[model samples]
Target: MMIILKSKKRQPHQTEKTIQILKDKLRERKIKSKIIVLENIEVFLNEKRVVMKINNWIPSKRSPVYFRIAERYKNASYIFSKYLEMKKVPFIDNYHTFTRERNKLIQMFLLAIKGISIPKTYYSPAYDSRKIRNAARFLKFPVVIKLTEKERGEGVFLAKNAVEIKRILGKNKGQEIILQEYLDNDFDYRILVLGHKTKLGETRTRTNKREFRNNACVGAVEEFFPAEEVPSDMKKISEQSSRIMNIQVCGVDIIRSRKGKIYVIEVNFSPGFTLDEKMDELNQTADYLKKWHEKKY
Candidate 1:
């Protein structure tokens, strides 16, 4: 069996580490696998044909298994996934799921529709002052302004009042931003769900005194806990959120409010694993792939 790991040109250091771990595990299992950076692949289209070429070689339709790990090259990933689908191939975390989870507005909408609790969020394609003001009216002060396409808390901001909201909107005139009710909490949970199981859970607390965001990239401290130690409600909601998003493996971010309400903040398609948990997560994923391959082939 051949397993292909597909990603974009530049990936995170942690992503590279996870790839190496997966490769090592697959090697030990004696499975043929390779990492195919989507940037290196070329697609050609014509009135009569469609072709995908990589390094002057055409990949076979028989290449059945694939795992997509990045969304930076979304168009390419979509085309490649369609090709594989046309050939009746199997892959982990299909293109639709990847794109859906990447969009915060769409993700929150879907989760809310599935009866999962999410913070009050407002989104619009065009930045409208009326919409912004209305969202502020509904959600009140201390709302979070998030760029729809950003991750790792890159475009996240806290607006204490309408003035801050207007200023933020003015600065990002053409960009798509969503306003969410800020849950006044010191920490949030990041739950990694694999298959139908919750593999690992961690609490990320802000290390900086002035920072409101609790992203690990922003110096948030992470403490991993066993699955049983996690709140039963959190595990259930995390798994349910992933299922609703059609993600076989994902990281679900859940936040608790000062009022003791649990809300799902985000669902990540390609969540990073800590060095200590990388081996275990990769091995579990490999075992899942093997079982899936056996059942299919």
Candidate 2:
């Protein structure tokens, strides 16, 4: 069995760690694997024989002049995903999974159609203050702002008033920003959904003044465990979201509102396991991916 793992261009350090762990797991299972870090793909000759490609990169570069070159490398991830379409591969998640997961608004819209409750969300291009202000006004104050394509809780801010929104947009001009209702909850769940199954889930809390943000990237603690028995309806909603989006695996961030309603905050395509980083869970998720790849390939 052949497997290919792709990751973002920057953050080579963290990607290296994940690749190592995955390589070790496949090796332990006596499976042959090929891992490709996309940003540095000039090292490998383009080949069509590879099976199971995992893509983790998002097009977030500064200049469109280099986009074609970057796209060539990014497209290789799709090529590998297509290879899985032809034969039995060890493990892989396709390009569409990455694409839909990267666009927060699109993902939310899909989930909403499947009967999942999400915060009222809107998006606008950069430099359109009037349009953004209008969307914010519609959602009401204390709205959450985010870059349309980002992970690890980066490029996200909560603005209370038009002045703060204007300040943020001024600082982050020339990018797609999403404005959404801020769910009122003290804790959030980082539920790792693998193949429609919740493989490993984590709960994050803001327990200290120094760390106000409840993101593992912001130094918040992560407590990992198997999913608490999710209601059947909720399980169906999660699975349907995954199926509709064609993702083999995802990290679903969910929140509980003041009215005690559950809402899906976001879905991550290439979610990192470092926050939990436990060997057993990693191995299990890897094994599941391996099985899924076997069926697809």
Candidate 3:
């Protein structure tokens, strides 16, 4: 698997055009290749072999893996490259260039750069409490504080104002935190995408009105439906976002603000599945996996 990557500052339209140009170039190429999105690639360490799945298709480590990763995603690429080396898998880019950069921040930055609407977020690596609090104040009241690595809404906190930010920050000192502008929405949609199509959709809502997170871990429930039932715009955005992230399978979490502006909240790399019953979803997933497995094998 060979990866090549690029970027420049331009207007949103220009950026869109550049992406299209890339797609065209990809189609015109004669050699076998694939677009490697950082989020789309899953590498597992706990397994017997260092299992690496790129959009469900396992690539042989014996094949040369090149790096054309973007500036924001280079750190993550470095990480993957290091793991490949540790496993004695062949790949370009070694530990000579490596840093444990924050992945969440880079993921969001990539989405935003691609013109996907996301909440205004601030990042601060500062050790001072006041510096962090000041960054939260820039986003106004009712901000969301998220610990970069924590998932399932565990490290997510809602801060109503500066005081709340202080209180939240005090409790989680030394944690990597990101301050985000809170979009007031009772519920959010999680559209599951595989390839260019959205396989399924669900609306996640908190059981209690006071809770800010719509995570199932937080006593929240999801109402699953077919892909056709999902809003067209939502599905398109989810597919587009997934494609941009180069993730073959992903859950795109989105929200509509009070003003009716749609925003992509998060694109889960390893999204969970919780259905009241398994019928179509199970079959769909099984078939999808089988198709890829057969094609790859």
Candidate 4:
């Protein structure tokens, strides 16, 4: 069986033409396929191998799974891909890429090496008060302390002074963290990039004055814009970052400082804007998958 492991319950009826395209393509190839929602599966990992119980049945090693799981299903994709790797099953968007995307520090380092502009960030392998404090000092009083394995915008923090930094260090003792130079910005841009093309763009702004993050999941207002409307530099940055990371479809978050300097915040491996109305992003991904399946099989 060929499994299309997706994030949504089902593609919407009217606007989901792209999904139908995928279905048609699969049918043409006589590939026995089914779409399974990622959230609906139960994965169990043990000493030697990994297993997944989907509804009342299980897919054997012979079944090839393509991960249509993106955006909010980051953790789920990671776990499932790990299971697939263990079982020596072929899958799209494998475990290594997802594993690397989980670490903010690593992402920043890779982007930086590729000449992508990012905020000055530092990390420590182990918990050390002096090391963390020194990093804060270098970044100045207003520093952003981000959990190395970031969880959306939830793990990001804003520390105004040394006292606050000290408090945060104590609170998250032994936790892998990274310190970044804080950049004051009204809002940040979430630009969706796919197949080296800019597709959808949106600016996220915090509605709550106290909140520093501009995440839609955290009650921030998102004003979306089409590809043409996105700034040229941002578009270039998003494309370059996507190419560097080898993520065909991903969200590249870019923030502009008060002085109008733009910096790449982070790259979201499993970005959620594929089903959007304007761009046929999902269709493009599915097309890629069809070709990949053909080549592999």
Ranking by TM-score: 3, 1, 2, 4
lDDT of 1 by residue, 1-297 (tens): 565656554667987888888888988998877776554554332213444555444566556556664545454455556556655667655644344334776676566545688887765434446656666776778989988778988999999988888898888875656788888898999988888678778899998999999998999998887778888999899999888878887889999888887999999988876656455556656777788789899
Of candidates 4 and 1, the better by lDDT: 1
What lDDT score is found at residue 145 in candidate 3? 84
Between the candidate structures 2 and 3, which one is better when assessed by lDDT? Answer: 3
The TM-scores, one per candidate, come to: 0.63, 0.61, 0.64, 0.60
Model 3: per-residue Cα lDDT over 1-297, one tens digit each: 344322232237765566556656766784345555454444322112334455455555555565544554454465456555655667655642455343565556556556677787665432245555555555667888888778778888888777788888789875756777889889988888887689999888899887889988888887888988988889888888887777877788899899987788888877887765665556667778899999999
Ranking 2 against 3 by TM-score, winner:
3
Decide which is better by TM-score, 3 or 4: 3
Q: Tens digit of lDDT per residue, candidate 2, span 36-141?
A: 4443321101111111211332222221111111242333444333333334333333432243234775666456545566777655332355655566666788
Superposed model 2: Cα runs more than 4 Å off:
1-101, 126-129, 210-212, 231-234, 275-277, 293-297
Candidate number with greatest lDDT: 1
1 or 3, which is superior by TM-score?
3
Off by over 4 Å in 4: 1-102, 273-297
* Residue 157, model 4: Cα distance from true site in angstroms: 1.3
List candidate 3 segments past 4 Å from native.
1-102, 127-130
Residue 252 of model 1 has an lDDT of 93
